[model samples]
Target: MTFLKPVLKSILLTLLIAFTASLNAQTHSKNGMVVSSDKSSSAVGAAILKKGGNAIDAAIATAFSLAVTHPSAGNIGGGGFIVFMNSEGKTTTIDFREKAPLSATNDMYLDQEGKLIDGINHFSAKAIGVPGTVAGLFLAHEKYGKLPWKDLLQPAIDQAKNGFAFNWSLYNAANYFTKEGNTNPFMDSYFRNESGGVTQPDEIWKQTELAETLIRIRDKGRDGFYKGKTAKMIASFMKKNDGIITKKDLAKYEAIERQPIKGSYKGYDIYSMPPPSSGGVALVEMMNLMELADLKTMEFNSSEHLHLVAEAMRRAFADRAEHLGDPDFNLNIPLDKLTSKEFAKKRFQGIDMTRASVSDSTKYGRLYDGENTTHLSTMDKDGNAVSLTYTLEYSFGSQMGSKELGFIFNNEMGDFNPQPGITKSNGQIGTAPNLVEPEKRMLSSMTPTIVGKNGKPYLVIGSPGGRTIINTVFQTVLNVLEFEMPVNKAIEALKIHHQWLPDQIVYEKYLLSPDTKKSLEAKGHTLKERNNMGALMGITYDPEKKIFTGASDSSQPDSGAVGY
Candidate 1:
């Protein structure tokens, strides 16, 4: 009897732990909800919602807050895309991706010898693009926001001026960047203390300069960033630092409203950003291919299931490299054919069920995107939804910015092909479609998406994984829409990525069992393990129950879901 009692206690403890984990994974709210990579940012969004702001208002507020709280990816010096769906289910998209400076040339990243210059493309002031984040946010607000722009911008300003608690993550990141050998002058000056040391955990870290910049944006709107003191400071910094961006570039930047790419999968409608973002084209194409199989009957994450998904991913990425690019620059992109069911069927027919297809770089473009970015999801009681993803193109971007402005410059120019017509086995592509050009927007894989069912928003989802973003969003959508998993489980589920050029599968650490890996290898697929893939912020709505289920990826220590 005593031995049996111990086993029973063990079983009970395990169940309790599972229950607790599930509870932490997701939150339910009857009204509006906001989920983001940082708790403070999420709380800011939720507070806006509580103050009668719609989803757009909340999204704008959350983005600004992230610029203050999560500076690694969120930024005014960077750019991103947004997918918005009104309560009526009508959808639109905004493309605010950074543009190459007017002085940028096709061979700018190459030396006189026509060879790529190591580190010059990404580590210098030349990498800073004309930022569009401010224009993008202000445009969305002008069209759909329910709250005053001043109100939405105030929270971030307050956080930057009055200071916010520096947590362990912020402290560690600052310390790492300020270390003796790795020190960045701008990083050390702004992110550290008056004593010339890293900001300690729990200390109040303030950025009076960033606050002043935000105030300009609040008062003057878009001109606050592009035409005023902020613009002059940015232009002067670039000029003195041997960079080419000028006041003219800043004044000329504008955010465009593009038609959302629409695709249907198993009766649900998926809407996502169009090019210059490859995210939508690749995601819809993958979904189209997955629809060819009855994924519902396959065991989740089993070798067969992952194989099919990977095969689809490979084909989609190949297509992405070959056909997609900045729409304004490459006007011939066959977006219609690429995302069509017929096109998917044609690609699906080539998948070998028993073996992985060979990825020939000769036929595909290289994946040159960086992995550091941030995403957020917001939903209001009015049924308006917004999925936003933004980035600085690398962790802390170029590690360069104006000390006076207190913002990091985006390394987005690195996303363009550094060398033309030079595809490498190491995954460097010199494809023409993404070559740098004056005032051209670079290609990206930032996938911000909204899924609709029965003319209402069923899900708002996005992630920040650079080249891996399309696959991450595809997998999350599959987990919920196809496998019928709960919102939290869908987010926490292990993810895999295949970029087609590398011809290898990158799976989350421990995502596949030994047998599954062996089985995949037997099918001639090469596999590599990564710590994790993405930090997703997602929201799922139950129309029948009128409940919004919000989820923030647990992998990010500060991620949170807040609602009111």
Candidate 2:
């Protein structure tokens, strides 16, 4: 009897753990709406929807909250891109990418020895670019938002003021910050207590300074951050840190509204961010090339289909590296040449049915030149939809925190090619087309996308990853349109990426079958295995039922959609 009792107790404990894990993995739902991300941020977004705000309003609120709650990823100190499709069938791209400081020269990072010092170039204030997140969000709200600016900013302000309970995920991310051996003195102060250690779950974390800053922004509008006290604090901090940002940089910064890059795939109109961001153009080119194949019939993740997608990514990336850059600075990009049917066919011709092509051998046609800055998508009851993505570059930007502002600055200048000889005709040095230039926006991989079927919005989606942005969004779109998988499953499925520089195709371990790898190896494709890939957020609208279904990536600890 005693032995039997012990066995029963063990079984009960195992069952309990399994059940709790399952519950954690599933999403918490609301009316007909869904918000997804790491914990508190998701909840904040859902609360906004419940408050009568539309998708854009909810997304804006969520963005600000994330800037506080998920400080590791979101911030007002960086820049990103937004792609939106309003109810009227119109689409636009808002470019708010960070610009280089005017004092920035092409070879600013080069030392007398001409060697690029890893930490010096990437971790200093000199590496910080002019932030555009505030301008981007403001532009979005002015155009498509239904809620008042103050109303949208209120949630985050409150959250920052009234401290929130830290969770295990936040604890883990903070731990990573320390483990990276590069913790900025400023972050160390906020993320730690008086003991100078990471805070654990259930601990109270309050961002009083940030709350006050948000309050000021709400009261003074975008001007609050750009030209007022907030700007002064940021500029002062830059000066102290030997950074080049000035009052003029902040006052002159503007988020430009541009047309979304458009393409068609299997009868659906696809819209994504345009140049300065290489994502939209690269994505469109990949889809155009893919249109030549009958992918709908191919088995999902089958070696053949997977290999083909990999090849397509490689070719597109080859072109991306060679010609894509900021349009304002580079010669007008031959958009026609890149997306033309003829160009697609010619690029596809390089792919051998039986094997993968070598990276250097994949050729793109004549090109003249060119290109997270996070994504949030919103749809109003009036049929207006917005897709916005914002970021601070790597986690916490340059990790240079402002004590007064209680925010981190972005290290986007590292994104520029620091090689000495890369220069532009305007005497701009280190300006590898995509390189840093004063007031010149840095290039990005953010690809916020909207797909419309039969002239109506169907899907609003995007992702976060330094260079994996395009491939993640591309694969998810195809999973729905070509593979016909439900949104949730498509997001959960394994992903593969090939960027051409590493000269290897990286795949999630779960996605690649031994047979598939062996077959690809036989075809001369270099294969690399990775555990996790990227995080994706997307919503698909069912025009027939007029219902919106949202799905967020499971790879992240917190991310799911809520529908009302």
Best prediction by TM-score: 1
Q: Show model 1 residue runs off by greater than 4 Å.
A: 1-24, 365-368
Residue-by-residue lDDT tens digits, candidate 2, 373-400: 3555555555556676777777677778
- Global lDDT scores for all candidate models: 0.90, 0.75
The clash count for each model shown is 0, 27
User: Which predicted model would earn the best lDDT?
Assistant: 1
Which 10-residue window of candidate 1 scores lowest in summed lDDT? Answer: 361-370
TM-score of 2: 0.90
Per-model TM-score versus the true fold: 0.95, 0.90
**Candidate 1 C-alpha lDDT tens digits along 1-564:** 988997997788668547645645788899999999899999999999999999999999999999999999989999999999999999999999999999999889888899999998899999888999999999999998889999999999999999999988888788777778865678777678766667888889998899999999999999999997999999999989999999999999999999999999999999998999999998899999889998768789989999999999988888887877788989899999988999888888888889888888886623217889999999999899999999999988888998789889899999998899998766787788899999999999999999999999999999998899999999999899988988788887879999887889999874567799999999999999998899889999998999999988777888899998
